[model samples]
Structure formats: structure tokens, C-alpha cells
Target: MAATLQLNTTKWSLNSNQSDVLIKARHSIIAYISGSLNKFKGSIDMQNNEVEDACIEFNLDVKNQESTLKNIDSPLYINDYLDSNTFPNITFKSTSFQKISSNINFLKGNLTVNNITKTVELDAQLINITIQNGTKTAIFEISGLIKRNDFDLVANAYNHTNGISLGQDITLTANLEFVI
Candidate 1:
């Protein structure tokens, strides 16, 4: 008699304390400014220990961002740029998650920001997976580029001649940890 292996779907929750979500954009056409989104929640559904048919959903608190730019008070102000007062959340729901290689995957989803929804594709890399104390944990790094103008994330009354013009392209990177 041959033994058959049973594969079941598992749901994983994001460990926000062990994760980091960052955004980088060009500042004044020379320097760059970076910021971190501190509060977020997400989940992943995996079957047979693979990401080929995984479903990912994430939500970020726009009002909880922290900037890394120094000497400036309220760098990338929430109301000035993101208008967090109107839209307090940035959300993503994956339509498909395809594995390209053993560690590389492509994630296509609808990203909603500032009340605008757009389809975006991001690169996902499996960093590591570990089993500790009968718990399964997985770490992944997700990254991609998005345009600020596409989502109306630009400030209307900003002075451009003062060497403070923000760039259109914004790079987003998230190091996410999930536990099952």
C-alpha cells in the first residue's frame, strides 16, 4: 500500500511588529526622501505550501506614516500630499499570485489609494521560512514602483521653485512577516 499525502489550505496573518513597509521618492531632482508606514494589517492564504494560488490582502493606515527626512517639520505632510483626512486607508487585494521561480513571484492586484483604485503588479520574493515551536513563519519582500500623479497624491499649493519639487515615481518596499 502507498501512503497519500494530505495538503490543505492554511491562512497566515501578518506580524506587523516584525514587518516594515517603506516608500521612497525623489526630492528636488537630486536627493531622495524615504518614509515608513507604521500601521498595517494583511493576510495570506496558501495551499500545499506554495504561493502559486495564494491570495493576499493588505491594508495600510495612511495617518500612521513616519518620514525619514531631517530638519523639516512634518515632512511629506499627510494632508498636503496623501490627503489622509479624506482617505485614511490604502488597501490592496491580490487578483493573482504567480510563482516565477523557487523564490520569486509576481503579484497582481488592485491597489486603492486616495479613493482611487488601480491595478498594480509587484515583485514578491520569498526571503525565508522557518518552523519554530510548532509554528510556521514565512518572510517575504515585496517591491514595486507607483506614480504619484496616477493617484492624485501631489500637493496643490506647493512651491516648486524653492527646490522642493516632488517626483512622480514612488518606490514601495515592504518586508512582511507572516505566521500560520
Candidate 2:
């Protein structure tokens, strides 16, 4: 039997320097672009190196996103996009976990954006877990896909002429580091 690593604390937080959430989508008829949420916060609970019965929450600051494409970055703060002034935060809260292995799991959660909430599943990987200097840290790689239309983010809906047609599918990935 494999040894279970006990949780040093029931609470953990995201290390900003080591954690980030990135999103990718088709920019036009021929290219894909990527952007990242510059600010976010997370909290989770675990008892045995597994988030078996805890709610994992991540709150993202949508106003501070960064992307190389100016056309894509500028509209993200307006009413048709994220509406940063109104819906400044995008969030996710885990409801359950489907364990595939000791290091792999599918987290089912509610992802909320633009005041709309939808159920989404995140493929999660336990990249590393270690204890050093009397502190415990865990790193996770998570990815998922969602439709921007579902959240009413249709800023580029009719802008094909500008060579900017944002795709409906948005792929989100994150390397989250949690410490306790």
C-alpha cells in the first residue's frame, strides 16, 4: 500500500509567482491567441494529499488580463466582454472529484463569469507534492474548455472585417501552486 501524506493544514493559498491561469482561443480565421489572468486567489482543503472532500475555489481578476493582441486585450474590459466594471471577477468552486489515479483527478465544479454560472469539469494533475522547511507545498496542472458564448462574451461577434473573430471555444490551463 502507498503511504498517505497528511495535510499540514486544512487551508492553502495560491503562490502568485508560481501560479497562473491562461486562456487560448482563435483570434481570426487563421490564428490563435493566448492571454492570462494577471491576478487571482485560491483556497482548498485536503487531508491526505488529495482534495477528496473539500471545495476548491479560485477567484480571478478579469480586469488585469494580459495578451499580445491589443484587439483581444482591449475589449475584455468592456460590457460586451468581461465587463470588468460590473463583473470584475471570474470564479470556480469545486463540488466533487472523480479520482482516476493517485496523481490524476477530474474536478467537477461551477465556473462563474459575467454573472453566469455553469458546471464544468477540470482535468487535474498532481505535478508535485513536497515538504521543505517545515512547510508543505503542492503543485497542480489543470485544464478545461468552455464556450465564451455561454457567458455572453461576444465582443467580437461581428468583427470579421477586422481580422478578429474570437472562437467560441476557450481553453483554459493553469499551473497552480498551493502552500500550507
Best by TM-score: 1
Off by over 4 Å in 2: 1-17, 28-54, 64-86, 131-134, 155-161
lDDT tens per residue, model 2, 1-180: 999975464677767556766655655422112224344456666656776533466677655446332334433323334555678777887788787777678988899988899999989877888898997898877788878878877646654334445667767777788888
Question: Against the unseen true structure, what C-alpha lDDT does each candidate score?
Answer: 0.68, 0.65
Clashing residue pairs for model 2: none
TM-score of every candidate: 0.70, 0.66
lDDT of 1 at 119: 96
